[model samples]
Target: MSGADLSRLSLNTATVKHADLRTAVDAAASAGYGAVGLWRDRVQEVGAERAARIVAEAGLRVSSLCRGGFLTAADDAGVEAALDDNRRAIDEAATVGTRELVFVVGGLSGSSPGGPPGAATDRDLVATRSRVADRLAELAPFAEARGVRIALEPLHPVFAADRAVISTLAQALDLAAPFAPGAVGVVVDTYHVWWDPELRAGVARAGREGRLACYQVCDWILPLASDALLSRGHVGDGYVDFAAVTTWVADAGYRGDVEVEIFNETVWDAPVAATVATVAERWERHVAPHLAPSPGAGMRLLDAPGERP
Candidate 1:
């Protein structure tokens, strides 16, 4: 694909966190990316207003906010606090002109601070998922009113005990189905869902139901470490076949930006500019070819006239 064609790819800021928000945005824009996926902490670090200005000035689109979940807890007070935080996050995304807010639906209530410690157990996993769904139902209307779509990201099952209770696209869709149309959706991250036995069916279901909001691309590795959360592989460096996954999504009618969301510590240790450049290059060479619009393809990349070449 041409550089212009590669412009459809977006860089999620976590892929290059060695730099601050301003530096990451600058690098993404300089590398000819169309959009960026942002993390709330980074925005807060730089000040949301300043971050908004920087992104707007660089002509970079905020593809999606990295997070707004963790609303599920063991108590009402914690859930309320999470809702309040989510409202603020919505405001930030609106201020930055982003349309989607990715949510990592949190784990059992007692697993984290503010949670009822020791309440999380294998026996309570189902109850925890129900709690998350109820919370999502409450927050969906608030997000919808702000024009921010909630993209529920299902984390790997390895994180089922502590990171996210929603661990599969199927579960995410079921939880989101109670909401009004377009209010809730799922974020398909290759790193998280690559090992799912029902991945293709889940992608199809997401696309068929119009519940696919964000498509984050990354690779997964084996000999998995038990303690590392940021050791994700770059595109094509691991076992995932991006070609097949993107084709499945494209066939299912998704036409949004293909976000490169590598959270690998190795990538983060590199200079921001180098990391962004390498991600953009790898995305084009490995992932873009799969998502490219062919004459008979079901969906096409949104036309980006005047985008840098």
Candidate 2:
């Protein structure tokens, strides 16, 4: 990707969840990572305001917020509460000087209610996904008014019954369709979408529509973890075709940070600093080579900490 250094890499805090906000930011900056993707839980520990200051002081940009969704509530109050929470997520994004707030839109209504996994019929799934669209109708404007974009993230289909109903890049793009591209967009995460047969086309469509908000990278580990949710590996640790998929995304005209978001327990147990360094090295090896040249060359300035957007 045009003699790229570590300047374009971002480390998602989940890669080092063992560390607090300050520590994660420290490790990110120390490793020369340009940005970090944060989760709301991490921000709540130190508060968004303080967290923003810490990141600023470390000279690292907050690439994108982890989440702001769970729109599967069955009641009006539940729906309203979900929307309100997303609004607050938007405010947090603004306060932290970020433009993209990632949303992991939940699956079927009551699908995983009461802290246990649940199932739904086709009708239930359709209705629940429709509700998601309606909620977006409300949440998108709220975000746009404050100069924020709602980045809808489609989790792996394995999560379709309980985590996110949106299972593919095409689905995410469709949901983001009816709104201005800047107001509602989609996250192209390799861990979740790498297996999609239409991945290349979906990415190209996302770019053509101007709805490509963020590009996340992580290996899809096999022999899934007991809690498969934590099965993510470093960029090259598993079987994902880093070069092919990333080349598709880069060729689609995305010029933002390429975030390394791993969730493996083993990686978390290692020293956070070493973990960051290893991720950087792996990214440069397996991910960087596939990236197309940056879209605008040196014309885009690093406006927020170490990020371009």
Candidate 3:
């Protein structure tokens, strides 16, 4: 296989929840990753100022922030609060030098009478989608002003009931179309979108329209767990074919970082260093080979530390 650059691999902080923000950044740097993705809560915990310094000191690129979602609460007060929070997230991203703020637009307010109250009933899905789009409209300008792109990540259908009504890439792109170029776009997370029937088409559309701002990788399992939110699999552990997905992404002209943003309980339980090392190894052994040139080619794969192999 031809050599491929592993410098494009990024570590999303949530993958190593065992560590704090500074430690996560340091670990990613030490592990030879090209960049690191941060979580807002962790940044808050470490104090944004300190977190920013650590990342910069490590010479790590802040790829994107994990979230600035929950912008679709039922009441105006909740909506306002979400907006305020998102603005702060944007500020934080800017301070940390991240170019994108990933958003998981939240689900409806209140649980269903029989099940999760926040799960949208047939009557409310459309309205909820509209509210989310409107909220995005309201915040897009401010985010753009701060030089932060809003990457609207369409969570999987499993999360449609309680996380986001926008469960498809098509819908996310449509929602972002109203905003300026690069101002609002969609994040393609393999865990959420790998099963989409229109996955290739959606990705092609994203590329065609220049709306593909972020790309995340994780795995999805069959016999989905009773609780779907936290059961994400690692890169090669489950059903997702990262080789195919990566091909499509690269073919679609996405030259951005391929971020690994797993939130599995199993991964989180491991020590942060072990977790980072495992992800790096997985990226090299599994994901990287597929991106290499055809067999018999003579090329050197770029190492994780930005050195050519």
Taking the candidates one at a time, how many backbone clashes does each contain? 0, 0, 7
**lDDT (tens digit, per residue) of candidate 3 on 67-125:** 88777676778788998999998898888788889998877655332264533434477
> What lDDT would each prediction earn against the true structure?
0.79, 0.84, 0.79
lDDT digits (tens) for residues 211-275 of candidate 2 = 88999999998899988888998888888998888877776667888888888899999998789
Residue 76, model 3, lDDT: 79
- Deviation of model 3 at 49, angstroms: 2.6
Candidate ranking under TM-score, highest first, comes to 2, 1, 3
Q: Residue 25 of candidate 2: its Cα lDDT?
A: 89
Identify the superior model by TM-score, candidate 2 or candidate 3.
Answer: 2
Residue pairs clashing, model 3: 110-117, 110-118, 111-116, 111-117, 111-118, 112-116, 112-117
lDDT of 2 at 144: 96
